[model samples]
Target: METVRQRQQRRQSDAAAHRQRYTNNPQLHKFTLKFSEDTDVGNYFASHRIDVTNSTICNHCNALKLPTESPGMCCSNGKVVLMEPTIPPLLQHLFTSQDDIAKDFHDKIRFYNSAFTFASVGVRFDRELANAKNGIYTFRVQGSFYHRIGLLLPEAGSNPHYLQMYIYDTQHELHHRTNTIPNSNLNPAIVEDIKAILDEVNPYSINFRYISNFPEEDIKNLSMLIHTNIPGLDQRTHNVPTAPQVAAIWINNNVPPGAIQKRDILLRTRMNQLIHISEFSG
Candidate 1:
């Protein structure tokens, strides 16, 4: 196992070698060495390269996952319902001053976690495909959401997100993502305050999961905020949702999607059969 100090030294050596390779190539340097922080942060990151504080659940701590072992041994797998609801910080200073810990965090591009990712939208239902059992439709969901984008609001968009900021390309594409979100129906004060807390160019949000059937067209980009309770919010490495609250999001489904407009009698949950209580079912 490599010690942290040894790892740092190796990283520095690797970076030096990389720069040495590009030093003679002026044109390539002009293209790649654009960001002032480029040398500080190289191209790729391994799973181990991620700092201890970044991952909410640890494969080792929670599940005892080993480098040699496969996943799915514990809650760290990220598939099960989160046992603990310790959601991480919404924001961190990417440009840290002269502190070792801060430098260590920022050195690895900590802001990248807060940065947005592309999320494809649009879901179609195809009965023809369903009939053949080849899968109902072509889920050709494209377009990154401007809102604190998907699977994990950090649920994780925007075209390329604010990734171009690192390279300083896509000048025209860089714009306020939340600006496109319709907020006429929401509390402008909350929105404004949250927006103020966020960087206009690179926004970050806590993860969100909800059970509502509200369509994207109906609610628009502000869906995550609506479902989550952002009050003097609980703070942790990863601010997790409260357990009962999260459970309610799914369990209390009075109605299930069956038909276009309740026309499908086969699928609709009748009032009596809506919920099956163990005591009442008997």
Candidate 2:
């Protein structure tokens, strides 16, 4: 009963609505990966170099794939595929500048001082306690005095990724005992607050310590985190991955045991509590 023009207009309106919903709805965006057999999904994504780890295909989209794996056989039947946003430009800039500073100064006193300022703070993963299955880990470090440090788990590619940085404070200190210099301005409250939040998520058990002199082991771990990405490449290198990419690498490399143990404990405790309440109510 509808005219051709009316049908076209209706389709356009439907598409506009779908786009709006996809962009605004977080739940809709969190769906996992899917794929179809009939289509050449790999070829289609070649230009974009889709990160297999992050990409996902919806059930509807997967249904459209043909049985063949050939390039021409795979075709999109107007099915929508959602893609996650790339790393933020600000993070990319920070990494780029940090890499440049490292190359220019190496390990000179001036370079080390500048590196601390640029990274805003120093952080290290306590490998002795990190575990992947339980998803808990400890971290310790020294940095600008009284600076506000924050740990962030920004949503990325259907998975939440974490980052920690110092938001405030910048100062220097000297260690009188060894006549050595250290970043004395680090804050204890920030570390405790981070641990408290981790306690709730139960992702990892975290312990934080502030020291006048950087712990040798902690410094080693922090160095690994900062230089986890490509050695000499800038933000635009073809093979050089993004900040999220490097963060993923760092997490994969360091899995703490204590953190995992705590995560299991928290998860079981919460689950049991919920079950008890449910039974009583019913």
Candidate 3:
């Protein structure tokens, strides 16, 4: 029995084989002699003495690259969703700011692979959803996520661990700053201060990640609907409203003069280009 993983691997292998076969001979049965390769496009650019800015090595796939064409899309295309977290403005200050105060957090980032990872805790389970007789158990997944200072695990009897700092500060951490960090002079305050910065900028990181992921998913979904048989969502693209449509909702009562000029121009241009073409007689 082929598992889900095995089926996915097999499909991928078949796709690679098919693409290789097409690349070897790109001839079509009755097409207008149009053809294209499936791999290694960089070689063609190199042969033509064209130096492309993007590297031939894909940063995401690492296994495939089409630097001259799609730098990162050669492998995943729209199937894989890559979520890039937007760094909050305040978070970037620690890394780039040259202020004397911010330099403390900046050093820890360079020295240790220090990063912020917050976990949401404590949610009330709805009685209707948690009915054991019907075998349904779920918790409401909603809360305000924030960063903390101490070890990842909550200390015993601590209601909220947001402000609790690890007093021990361990030899590995304490000695790390004292021995190697600049202006240390056996100072232990660096550890606590760094943690403080991470706590304050917690929500910024979450918002950034969600914003980046929110659109990439829908855009990829829109691509799939291009070939769909559905009428309304075809190339009309009603999923995302146009600028004019969005603006019209706000100023429904009083539309400014010349407001529809841009829309009128587009309509006129489309109408002009719709000329009847005579069939070719050979």
Candidate 4:
């Protein structure tokens, strides 16, 4: 296996070679060389890169200090050069910053992760067959999402209970109508299925939160409230619903089509609302 240092050296060499090629033929590889931080450094990165801090989480320690150099390439700030047919001067004159023009073409090129669940949301672009006729260059955008279910499970010592989860695409007026996972905590099959779905959607921003569902009985009760759309559940003696206290979460049940709503559903328990433990009708 190649060591980390060796990998870096190889990458640097490749970048230097790429830069050298661009230098020989500046007109052909102008965009790739445009963002070179220095002529000497190979493999110029064009996107915005975020830095890490000592407080970031790791398996060994949370406070471990990391070196200043980033381990890998950073995310791009949504900028791409239109290398084909080089837009007409009339169109080029309309934009000030190349970045702004990229934005104007695809205003919604972004990704997000919910802070309340292990779901990542992002956009996917395909360049294979974009604007072939017009001599223009572009991409086909597809919505994508990824979720990790294990993170939201209850701790080993906690009382075991049945749970169900679903994902909704607020942007497209679509949802996983069926229960995506049933009796989730007790079964490993649900995790496998969820991974499959993640591969299918392929969302860009995946957000994970320390979230777990209320017991099956609790979710059934909350579903009743949502179904009825009750003005308010009595809470005089009840504690305000907060994180780690939710009953259940479902997205896009009744929202209007093509509407962008908050992606998370946090269900919490309020003491004022009655919770009855019903006997199973086996």
Per-residue alpha-carbon lDDT of candidate 3 for residues 2-34, written as tens digits (9 for 90 to 100):
999998889779866854664466352122323
Q: Candidate 1 on 146-226: residue-level lDDT in tens?
A: 232122111114332332322222233223333323342223333333333443323232111121223456855332323
For every candidate, C-alpha RMSD to the true structure in Å: 27.5, 29.0, 25.1, 25.5
lDDT score at residue 282, model 2, on the 0-100 scale:
12
- Mark the 10 consecutive residues where model 1 has the least summed lDDT: 147-156
Given candidate 2, what's the lDDT at residue 120? 34
Candidate 4's TM-score: 0.16
Overall local distance difference test of candidate 2: 0.36
Runs with alpha carbons beyond 4 Å of true place in candidate 3? 1-50, 53-75, 104-193, 197-282
| TM-score ranking from best candidate downward | 3, 1, 2, 4
lDDT at position 49, candidate 3: 62
C-alpha-based local distance difference test score of model 1: 0.37
Candidate lDDT values, in order: 0.37, 0.36, 0.44, 0.36
TM-score for each candidate, following the candidate numbering: 0.17, 0.17, 0.24, 0.16
Per-residue alpha-carbon lDDT of candidate 2 for residues 1-282, written as tens digits (9 for 90 to 100): 999999888977986686577557756434544568787776656464433553334344443333333332333433445554564443344345556443333334352333223123324333433433322333433222332222332123322111221211112111111112245332333233333343344322222112312445664533223443675667454432333323222142476656533211111232222111221121
* TM-score-best of 1 and 3: 3
Q: Native-vs-model 3 lDDT? A: 0.44
